[model samples]
Target: MRLTSGPAHSLVQLDTIPLGDWRALCDRALEPNGYYLPDWEAAVNASARGRTDTSALCVWNDGPPARLIGLMPVTSLRRAYKVPLPALVSGHPYGTLCTPLVDRDLAEPAVTQLLQAARQAGARALLLRDVALEGAVMQAISSALAREGLKPRVLQSYSRACLDATGDGDDMLRDALGPKKLKELRRQRHRLAEHGPVSFDIARTPRQVALALEAFLELEASGWKGRRGTALIQHEGDAAFIRRAAPALAANSQCEVVTLRSGDTAVASGVVLRHQSRAFFFKLGVDERYAKYSPGVQLTIALTRHLCADPAIASADSTAAPDHPMINPIWRGRLVIGDVLLPLRARDPLVELIHAALAARRGALDVARRGVHILRGLRTR
Candidate 1:
């Protein structure tokens, strides 16, 4: 791959790549790649409208046909007067789980070339996060940047869960819960069924998704989540994003609702997301009136069975909090990845030192709040 460098505009370097070029590269590089999804499209749309200041480019293999083998999102941060101006190329507000959208074979070269290009453009540094594709990408790029005399660091320390689809729902549950927890899960499930008929439905069509999401809102508002002002459609930003992205989010799949219905009334409900071959239990809400039955736990069990019945899915990706009791027990296998943490690095040496000292004191407050109990025990004892 050839390299070129120069500040693009007020943005700097590769982000200076015209938007047209960026999108064209993104579309070509990601469309047929392993991790392509509508979220990427949404990111592009938002970037085009100035809601974002991210830039990216397609890396092509060295060949006559010139195939798009990788892509990166570049962001420029202005320096604070003291430190050398450094630009960051990362999966920012625009990304969470970012894997290069190139032929798997070209992942290494693509990463190396992209960073070298950034260096040539005069960026003092770069960072990559939420990396899901190749470890080689991070290592190779960081090495390339280092040879150019700039310090590059790769931090590999985060975990994400991915499901493997091989056995019956019973098997999956057994794996998640082991012997003791599985017994509890079964007990809760039977208890819920005794109350009345419990229905777990995944809504794919537009009408059904709309109805189901509406119920999710109601369920969320019924419990302590609502008491503390935590609702699914809480903030206008969240509601607006979901509304705008609904069509694209559902183009490949829809919202999964696990509900316990006694006659016509829904007693408990949880929201699930089925995307491609992965099914995620994203959110859940149970009416406080139905708390006696451990609705959330039972709903999870039913969803596990649904996952078994669906041949397209493999593992359950629990977006549950790191220490979630119900979810942690049920998900044993782990896939660790990188997290993008943005810290202020560039600034005037002496003055910035003062700022850093102040920031360190504030950072200690974050470490002190370890027992922040936002979630109460809605689960049955």
Candidate 2:
């Protein structure tokens, strides 16, 4: 249903978004975000936990054939942030990044229309989570806000590991890991190889990806994540979402499942998504029995080489937490990600209230987490 009277903008249920228009927008998006692409995001909205309530704020260019210029999947502020406010938050698409898709040619107007649509939806602000703080899309957003005598406020920010994949794969790895670390990794690889001929394989075709995803799910379910009940396979919705998403994205050459195997045994695997010249390392699953061999790190090293060797890929986002021990050392590059608050009106007081509420909530959560940790420590002692 249209959320605004103007044909230029509307808020419609996520699953109801037109695929042709969505794909067209994605093709010419001002900043590419694989997580927001139609195939990936649609599956997420349909099957991912807590995503069923998503709605897309869509901006259209009213041509003889209407063209979609911008789209962001969002949910109610109460549901997303538990703040009971008139706002919206970017819907989680099973990835860390949530930059919206905006047509590069119509970026300025599209962003203006997007904010207007949010306003029409009765929102005083828009909370975009896990967006690239310095990316092209954010620049467009800032420009749009500036014209309205408003500005986007960064609520939270962190630097995540990324990869500069433009250089020679071997040279990049050698420089990043250094001789001593590289030698140790090599020794680990040699010891691991005693199990069999260790090899790295990539699945790009839909059929190949579908098959490989099974191995990835099984491998992930056999590790620490499994015991902690956090593996995708442990949740029916997460499993269904990925199962549907991977093959569909693979069909368009936008997805790959990489596996590192020792003979017939799959030691580690990961899902990677591509958009424009960038690749996102989505998630990794490893057989912890091979932890001593650093199978995850070995797979990552191979993935680093694999991505660097691809001429079309200029960079890769690790999509990991800030200062992630596993990938920070391997991929030395960084990308600033943040939760930004876009005020719908100039100097809206609600914006400040929302910001304060979020900060307080964050502080309380941190304190509670510390308390839990201390309590557990005391119990153990």
TM-score to native of every candidate shown = 0.68, 0.97
**Cα distance off (Å), candidate 2, residue 100:** 0.7
- Candidate 1, RMSD to the unseen true structure: 6.9
Assess each prediction's global lDDT (C-alpha) against the native: 0.53, 0.91
lDDT at position 154, candidate 2: 92
Stretches of model 2 off by over 4 angstroms after superposition: 379-381
lDDT of 1 by residue, 1-381 (tens): 123532221223333434444334444442222222334334343532332534454455656655555665555433222223354445443224454444346545665666555556555445454564334444555454445543333344455554566578788877677889677766766676776766666666656666776777778877778778756366454445444444345554634456667556676676565544566666777777767677777776777777778887776666544456765655665655563222222332533343343346446656666434322333323
Clashing pairs in 1: 69-102, 82-348, 83-347, 163-315, 164-315, 165-314
Evaluated against the true structure, the overall lDDT of model 2 is 0.91
Q: Which ten residues in a row have the lowest lDDT in candidate 1?
A: 1-10
Residue-level lDDT tens digits of model 2 in 117-190: 99898889999999999999999999999988888989889999999999998999899999999999999999
lDDT of 1 at 231: 64
TM-score of 2: 0.97
